[model samples]
Target: MSVALPRIDAIRDAAARIAPHAVVTPVMRNARLDALAGAQLFFKCENLQRGGAFKFRGACNAVWSLSDDEAARGVVTHSSGNHGNALAIAASTRGIPAHVVVPEGAVKAKLEAIEQAGAVLHRCAPNTPAREAAAAEVQRQTGADLVHPYADTRVMAGQGTLVLELLNQAGDLDIIVTPVGGGGLAAGCAIAAHALDSSIQMIAAEPEGADDAAQSLAQGSRIAGITANTICDGLRTLIGESNFEALQQHGTQVVTVSDDEVVAAMKTLWRELKLVIEPSSATVFAAVLKRPEQFAGKRVGLVLTGGNVDLEALPF
Candidate 1:
């Protein structure tokens, strides 16, 4: 069966819905980075976003898209960290209850941030099944709308807004790279980038430890069973079916980089651009650095996905 994907109109509407609240995150360039990669790089600074990640765009859009009665009932979701915090903040902004099902041993800083944002937290085993069960329980108890991370149409539409803003701000760009975990950002980006400029290449960066997106694309179907063992905590999840379908239809190429490469790229961003970003965010640069010849002399846009790293826990 063919799945319905987020359209350009939906993305445009999402942009309008989120503009009042979401920051039009800046596009940055670094001479050192450009020289190192042999391409002119444009980094969309989403680390400076409201919840310190591009996740806020989708979370906020989902929260606001709900009807008055639905909002009154509240919202629920499962996340490793960033998405939960974003949804919590979004729910708080709309004055609704937010319930987040978080895996045990998730980054302490992120869990703390979710609580601070006024979301009721439920702890579960550090796996998909437990997280989903907890979220289902919350939804049953509260009759809240289930704002799935990357699976729902509204969240995908919300994420597309990032590339919409990036395309307009970065001028003509030959390539756009984004870290792919649940595939929301990658799928959303593919839609927006292709619609605006069909010639632009959309690339999905995945950690070698968690390369389901790459394997799925290769196998012509979604693949699960790979054990994730990377420092990129935000990117360890399996891609949702809807998101996988979107990637396939949009012709997004997936590339895998080593965890060491991800860490190196993270340090580079911090030193060269003076920007603090999480390991997941650095995957985009890791992909580019891994294949400089592919992007040589081109204007490449990289989405700096988040900056929610715990200061004490340096991967390097």
Candidate 2:
């Protein structure tokens, strides 16, 4: 069976559904960073979003999309970090339970936040199959809905709302870039961005070590089973099937950057933009720096995906 992708209408509905819950995160600019990249950059500060990430938008949408009866059974999902925390928080607002199947060795701060948000945590081996199996078991046991971190259409529509807000805030961007993990955010952004203004370019910034999105796009098939070795823990997952389909449909472009470059860009954002974004979030900035010719003098919108860094484990 073919997967149904989120469309512009669905994304618009999501914007309305999640409006009361999600933040209209600020758009920031730094003259110094603009000069450094030779581009006019607008940073959508999702670092300051609720749950400290854009993951909340999708999670909130998924949680609330359920019927009251379905929500009573609650929601379950697998995540390295951000999505779990977002789901937990989103579920709480609706007075429902949340079961998160988190990988072993997932970010400590994120795990703590998930628990703090009142979600039950299930530990799994740090791999895709293991995580999915654990989440399935939880869903089977609890009769909860499985909100696949990126693949679910509702989740993708929720993620797309960010671009809707970005375009409304930043007006007439030449390019919009987002970090791609399971490709939910990028795919969603692609759908929304193209619908609003097909002239605007949509780019996915990826870690070179976990470049499955790039490889998948290049091969014209969803690539799987590559061991992710990036320091960006939030972005180590393979691209989701539905997300890949959306990307293919929208002709989204992919750009890869190294961990060293990500760290450099993270520091630059902290120093220049005063943003405490994590490694995964820094990939967009690193991509621009990596390919200045593509962005130079253009109005580039960068989605700073999250700010959930383990201060004690700073890469610098």
TM-score of each: 0.98, 0.98
Off by over 4 Å in 2: none
Native-structure RMSD, model 2: 1.0
| lDDT tens readout by residue for model 1, 1-316 | 1235789899999999988889999999999899999999999999999999999999999999999999999999999999999999999889999999999989988999999999999999999989889999988898999888888888888999999899889898999999999988888889988999999988999999999999999999898657898889999999988899988888899989999999999988899999899999999999999998899999999999999988998897
lDDT of model 1, residue 142: 89
**Predicted structure 2: clash tally:** 0
Clashes of each: 0, 0
User: Candidate 1, 90: how far from true, in Å?
Assistant: 0.6
Task: Pull out the clashing pairs in model 1.
Answer: none
C-alpha-based local distance difference test score of model 1: 0.92
